[model samples]
Target: MYAVFKRELFSLLNSLMAYITIGIFLLAAGLLLWFFPDTSILDYGYAELTGFFSLAPFLFMFLIPAICMRSFAEERREGTYILLATRPLTSWQIIGAKYFACLVLVVFSLVPTLIYGYTISKLAMPAGNVDTGAIIGSYIGLLLLGAAFTAIGIFASSITKNQVIAFAVAVFLCFIMYNGFDAMAKMALLTGLQDLFMFLSVNEHYQSISRGVLDTRDAVYFLTLVFFFLLLTHFTIGGRKW
Candidate 1:
């Protein structure tokens, strides 16, 4: 698993497209947080990263799929997945290695954004008036969200040999996971089931965690989402063999 992880990570690092994608994510984030008049934190007259936190998941909807689209799609396209499957590693191990590798790239994309928090802190009244707890909670939530998205992306990749198709499917799934339930919950006809829909929505749990409360339910929801998607990926690859 470690060997596969290392190789996958290095492969991503060696790809120019990976760098471009990460760079685009960071650049877009910076522009939204600092430059865009409507979304800019500076214009909001607050030290909080509410705007950033709100905008990030939307950006991630595209960025993560792009990162993971090549995971299995590229392998299968080049006929290298068969070679990979013949290795000693179990399906879970292979999936895990690829998932973690993609996740590490997500982490790398996020780590640079810490400077946003620090800058906000320094810009705050008295040199540090920002809500530290909220910022921490939001970061944690973002990480979990990214993890779940990575799992979904990996699962999408495992099902298709075309990277573009994997990307589109992953994006569609992520959007639905993040917003579809909440939308359905809002329908006048679904009032009776609103609670259930909200409970299943990724945005619901993400918002709960972003409030700096760190509820176990929200954490479990995210972990379960990640696990469920990964399990799907495992079944996907296994089915290809049979």
Candidate 2:
């Protein structure tokens, strides 16, 4: 498992697509949060990094799947997945290794954003006036959210040999998990089911953690979602492709 993890992680780091994906994610996020004329921090007239937290979830909805689309899909595309299945690893371990590899890259993509936090802290109306707790909590929410999406992406990749289909499926599932429930909750026809829909949404749990409360339920929600999808990936890999 560790060897598979290392191999997959290094493969991602050594690929051009990985850098392109990271660069695009950071560039779009940075511009939207602090540089774009309309949405920039300058326009917000505030010293908080809240705009970033507001924007990153939407950005991650696409960025993460782009990185993960090729994981199992590309392996199967190039006929390497068969060899991978022959290795001395359980389906769960193999899927876990791939999941962790993508997760490491996700963390790599997020670590640089800490600079935004530092800058916001010092650039506030009063030096260091930022709510450090909320910022930390938001960061935790973002990482957990990313991990959940990675699990979803790997599962999508496992179900198909087409990277494009994997990307589309991952994005659609991520979107539905992240916001579709909230949308459903707002529907007039589903008004009575609002609470249930919201509870099923990853965004609901993410918002709870971002509020700086660190609820155990929110943490469990994220872990449970990740586990469910990874388990699905293991089964998908062991079964026939869709």
Candidate 3:
């Protein structure tokens, strides 16, 4: 797992993909937080990091899929996946390693935003009245959400050898997972099942955590989502040779 993890991390950095993705994230963060006239964080006249976190995750919805699209799809296209498949690593380990590599990249790209938070803290009128706890909580939620997206993306990539189709499927699935349940909640037919739909939706739980309310239910939902898709990825790979 460690070897596969290292190889993935190294390969991502060795290509322009990592740099390009990071650049896109930073640019989106900047544009939304600074350049936008009305909703810009700089114009909000507050020291809170709310603007950054709110915008980051939505941007991540698209960005993360692009990052993971090539994970297995590239290997399949290049016919290098067989090499890794024959290794001693189990299917779960391979998928987990890829998931970890993608998670690391997501976390690494987010490191720069700490400075944005720090800047806000220093600029606060009282010199540090920022809700540090809420900010930290939001960051944790973001990490979990990113992890969930990466797992979904890896599963999508594994299902097909074409990166383009993998990317499309990943983006569509991520969008649905992120907000599909909430949308379903509004359906007249499912009116009585609102709670069930919300419970199944990622955005509902994610929003709860983003507000600094650490609910066990929300954590369990994300963990379950990650686990289910991961198991599916394992099955997809396992059934390939069967």
Candidate 4:
């Protein structure tokens, strides 16, 4: 597993696509948080990063899919997946390595954003008037969210040989998981099931954690979601073996 993980991580780092994807995410985030009039922190007259936290998931919806689309798709497309599978590693080990590799790229994209928090802290009226707890919670929530998205993306990649299709499917699934439940709950037909729908929404749990409370329920929901998607990927590749 470690060998696979190392190889996968190095593959991502060596790929120009990975650099471009991370670059775009950071660029867009910078524009939204510091330049755009509507969402810019400069106009907010405060040290809060509410705009960043709110907009990040939307950016991630596309970024993560792009990163993971080629994980298995390219392997299958080039007929290299067979070679990979013939190795000593178990299915879970392979999937785990790829998932963590993609996740590390996600973290690489996010780590630079810590500068934003630092800048905000220094800009505050007093030296550091920002809500440290909230920021910490939001970062934690974002990491968990990224992990779940990585699992979904890996699952999407495993089922298809077409990278484009994998990307589209992953993005669609991420969007639906993130917001569709909330939208469904608002419909008249689902009115009685609003609570349940909201409970299932990734955004709901993310927002809950972003509030600095660190509820175990939200953590469990994300962990379970990650596991569920990874399990799906295992089943998918396992089925292909037969």
Candidate 5:
């Protein structure tokens, strides 16, 4: 797992995909947070990172899919996925290593955005008057959400050899997972089951954690989402010929 993780992390960097992915994320985020007039944090008149947390999930929805689209799909397209079976690594390890590699990139991409938090802190009237707890909680929530998305992306990649198809499927699935359940909860018929639907929703749990409560249920929900998809990826890969 470590070997695969290191190889993937560096290989993407060597190919400049890592730089491009991180750059795009930062650029889009920076524009909205700093440059764009309507979305600028400076105009918000408050020391808060709310705009970032709110906008990031949507950005990551597409960004992460693009990042993982080539994980297995590229190997499969080039007829290299078959060669992976000869390695001693278990299917789960392979899936996990690659998943973590992608997750690391997601985390790495967020590092540059820390500047937003710093800027917000300084912009506060009292200087450092921001809600430290809330910011920390939101960052944690984002990381968890990103992890789930990474798993879904890798699973989508595993199912198809075409990178475009993988990206589309991953984005679709991430959208549904993130918001479909909450949308369902609004129906009068599902009102009684609203609790269940909210529980299933990535957005619902994310909002809960965003409040700085650090609820275990929300964390568990994200973990469950990640594990479920990784399991599916394991099966999908195992089904392929050795």
Candidate 6:
């Protein structure tokens, strides 16, 4: 498993995929939080990063797909899927390795954002009385959402051999998971299912965690979403052989 994981990770770094993904993420962060003066998190009266956290999910909608697009799709497109399938590794091992590699890529991009936190601290009136609680909570929420998006992207990639198609499908699915449910909830047609839709929506849990409140329900919801997509990816790969 470690060998497969390292191989996937090295492949990403060698191809500069990691660098490109990180660059895009940083660019989005800078544009949304730095260039926009009106709604930037820094402009808020409180030390909380409400604006930044709220904005990060939408940016991640595209960023996570870029990171996971080529994970399985590139292998399949190059006819390496057969080679991998014939190896001693199980399907789970291959999927797990790629999943883990994508996760590391997400974390790699996120680490640099800590600087924003540090800068916000110093800029705060009391030399670091910033709401570290909320900041930490928001970061946790980001990680969970990233994980869910990565899983969805991986599943989408597994269904197609073309990287571009995989990317497009992944982005569409990511957008749905991130915001589609909430939008559907607002529609008059689904008024009766409003509670169910809102509960199933990713934003509800994301918002709760971002407020520095780590509710167990939110954690469970994220875990369930991640597992559901992962299970779907596994089945998708398995079905291809039959």
Candidate 3 residue lDDT tens string, 132-164: 888888988988899899899999999998998
lDDT of 5 by residue, 1-242 (tens): 78888987786667566578778888999999877888888887778989899999999998899889989999888987777667888988888889988998899888888888898898899999999999999999999999999999999999999999999999999999988988888873855698788778899999899999998888888999899999999999888783
What stretches of model 6 exceed 4 Å from their correct place? 41-45, 188-192
For candidate 1, lDDT tens digit of each residue in 1-242?
99999999999999999999999999999999999999998899988899999999999999999999999999988998888888898999999999999999999999999999999999999899989999999999999999999999999999999999999999999999999999999983766699889999999999999999999989999999999999999889998862
TM-score of each model, in listed order = 0.98, 0.96, 0.96, 0.98, 0.96, 0.94
Model 1 accuracy (lDDT, Cα): 0.95
lDDT of each: 0.95, 0.90, 0.86, 0.95, 0.89, 0.86
Q: 50-96 in candidate 6: lDDT tens per residue? A: 77788888888888888888988898788888987888998889889
Candidate 5: misplaced stretches above 4 Å?
Answer: none
Stretches off by above 4 angstroms in model 4 are: 188-192
> Model 4: per-residue lDDT, tens digit, 15-66?
9999999999999999999999999999989899899999999999999999
* TM-score, cand. 1: 0.98
Model 5, residue 87: displacement in angstroms? 1.4
Name the lDDT value of residue 221 in candidate 6: 93
